[model samples]
Target: MNFGREAMMTSDIECDVRSLGDSGKQRAIFAHFDSLSVGQSLVLVNNRPIEHLRDAFDAEYAGSYSWQELEPRPRSWRVRIGKTASDALPRVVGHTSSGDLDRRSAVWSLPIQRRHDLDVTIVTLAPGTSTTPRPGPAVDTLVHVLAGTGTVTTELRDLDLDPGTLLWLPRHTPRSYTAGPDGLRYLRVRPHQQSPVPDSDGPW
Candidate 1:
């Protein structure tokens, strides 16, 4: 199997394969993103047919997999896999509005005694306004367009984003987004980062 940085970025983030039984039956796990652009795509493997694990968690922005047991012994047969675009299109779960943005996110993974490893959220922007630009603590972020059109004006540059576009923002970059006349809807994926604690004697 051949994998690359670019391929992984646009394709599904993870995969699982296992043998079913002595009859040679095989099972596979597959996940698809809503859109694909410079940083992401609806992940497909060289035209290989895969079935989604139903028990997996579906969040507002991203999906997650449950822990699955693997076969103890490795299969003798050789299997080759390649990266290619998927012919299947993505199905929309629903649209989210700015008012319900924070509460609408679905938690995919929860760790005991620690913060979550990943957090996914869907944000919708109404026409004629923009969100305040703010810096995240320290985590990488991936944004994918779901519906409508918009212009993302960042400190670095202005980018026109429509359906099927993805953007990757490094940790701590100050950024904001605004929607076009029709409004905008997109998914945001980011690693969990704790906020900094303010000193008792803060500066005015």
Candidate 2:
């Protein structure tokens, strides 16, 4: 058994509120750990005066917060806790409007739980708008069309995707997307460490 690989699996990204002053100002902290072991827990040392850590993963809730054990697989295998926010988190809100991409494109990132891996985001593209071309880091990605229609063009080929379609692209492969007349919506799933970077080689 290769415990070496398992032992080296730790959260590559972490965000927390670090401090708060008597003046009612708050500070945030973001840390990246090299590796983590199974059964070992990561603690959020928060100095905020709030009774509960605002963004810490809580174990007694559902929907608003969630935590998963990520090891030996890209997907989180265990759900130790769940979401618990009375109101939606920042990432849960829709940040884009119709015909918004041509002016100012947007990406709404959801709360994700992964260790040394990538996660997924549901992206909504405005009608007649397209994404900036770019290659992702060294990781595979799968785009699952949730609603609407679109065309995905890559350096290798072009694919017309609609609801129920799933498109796969490898890392660093140049790619772009154009929304249909009705607009496009899809879930982009990839490794946590390697996200798709915007490429300028193609038109947006």
Candidate 3:
């Protein structure tokens, strides 16, 4: 498998939350954790007991992740959280909204378990942001809005989007998206096994 330069070069990420406020700390840690790839791990350094985070992590990732308390310090605690190398059985994967972390014009995240047959992504677009028009992938796509609103422009027409809106885009259709004033967060799913678009010249 192609582990990619990212996962190969950054095997361990350190998240220091000692200086952040109570509420900000968990978000910071989780953001770092969410960015990790298989075989990569996060080293969390904090000022308080982080045993509670273990329960939170267990509740989110359970069998697909590992946690180990490192050597204790006088005032700091450290724990190594790793995404396990083993594959998980078919099961429910939990995820909340991207919320404040998806602050960029556009951002996307995959659920913990990435399956070979499907490419599932949570996409967030900041207010007034838009995705450049491009020919859709070779595989069919299903997009479901989870929050906010947007307009999806396809070859045929512009479709308005709202929370709970679900759209189907057939393979090879040209499409783009523009976020509403409130911004947009949606789920995009495609069949990973389908052949990709032939051209590789477009922006990523």
Using lDDT as the measure, which candidate wins?
Answer: 3
Question: By lDDT, is 2 or 3 better?
Answer: 3
RMSD of 3: 13.4
Question: What are the lDDT scores of the predictions, listed in order?
Answer: 0.46, 0.50, 0.70
lDDT of 3 by residue, 1-204 (tens): 222122222577888888988888878987787777888888777776765777776655668888766735646677778888443435655464755423433245443322246666777777888888898777788988988888998888999999999899888889888888888888778766434445321221
The digit string of per-residue lDDT tens for model 2 on 1-204 reads 332224333542332334345333222321211122323333332333333433433311224543443232322221122223442343333432222322323355445542224454667778877877786556677878867788988888889989999888877778888888877877777756634564223222
Candidate 1 Cα misplacement greater than 4 A, ranges: 1-115, 195-204
Q: Please count the clashing residue pairs in each candidate, in the order shown.
A: 3, 10, 0
Per-model TM-score versus the true fold: 0.42, 0.49, 0.50
Estimate, for each residue in 97-199, the C-alpha lDDT of model 1 and write its tens digit.
3343222222222321122465566676767457666664466778888777888877789899898899987766667777787777777766655546641
Cα error, candidate 3, residue 176 (Å): 0.6
Error of 1 at 171 (Å): 1.1
After superposition, the stretches of candidate 2 with alpha carbons farther than 4 Å from their true spots are 1-54, 59-108, 112-116, 194-204
Candidate 3 residue-wise lDDT at 79: 71
